[model samples]
Target: MESSLATSQMSDEIVCFCGQSSVTRTSLTANNPGQRFRSCSFYGQPDAWDYFSWVDPPPHPRYKAIINKLLRKDNSKRNDEQQLRRLVKCYQIALEVFLLGVIIQKIWL
Candidate 1:
């Protein structure tokens, strides 16, 4: 199974004072799901300073639900559009083949 944590190369701008880029993860709790943040590489070490930063604020539950719903709808629409395009291409090919057969019959006669 894939972990939910996202890995990124730490840049100079976001490096911890300890000179190491911290790993980033999203909160998966019921109250703070999808909240992104970064932590120091030496997090939890007795010698390391506490380092944490939020990359994005947690949205209201209602807002999150609405966003998820809209995303699902958008994905469904895209899949429908792709299926329609494939159907249209198949129809076009079939029409061309039929027309060619008709012309060949006329030529033989």
Candidate 2:
């Protein structure tokens, strides 16, 4: 399944009652996974007016399965990236500590 960003771009023709362009978004809930809708860009904000429209109908069961699979893959990649960032931070700290120890030893000699 393609990302909502692309769909939002294509929804430029859709405008809210407030005169703002509508944006496409995907439902991430367990029941409506990957469902696409167009809503006001400010939809959910304090100043938002009630506005919503569907960009695509609910996917067929087989397509839903495919979208769910892609969602899982994307989530896994995000998790892996986060873990790598944490690991790199730890390595950077360790390197800094090691360099500090080396500097202390040189000063004592």
Give the candidate number with the greatest TM-score: 2
Clashes of 2: 0
Best model number under lDDT? 2
What ranges in model 1 sit over 4 Å off?
1-54
lDDT of 1 by residue, 41-97 (tens): 666677774677788888788967766676678789999999999999999999999
Report lDDT per candidate: 0.72, 0.76
Per-model TM-score on C-alpha atoms: 0.51, 0.73
Name the lDDT of candidate 2. 0.76
lDDT of 2 by residue, 20-47 (tens): 6777898875556788888778777886
Q: Report model 1's TM-score to 2 decimal places.
A: 0.51
Candidate 2, run of 10 with poorest lDDT: 1-10
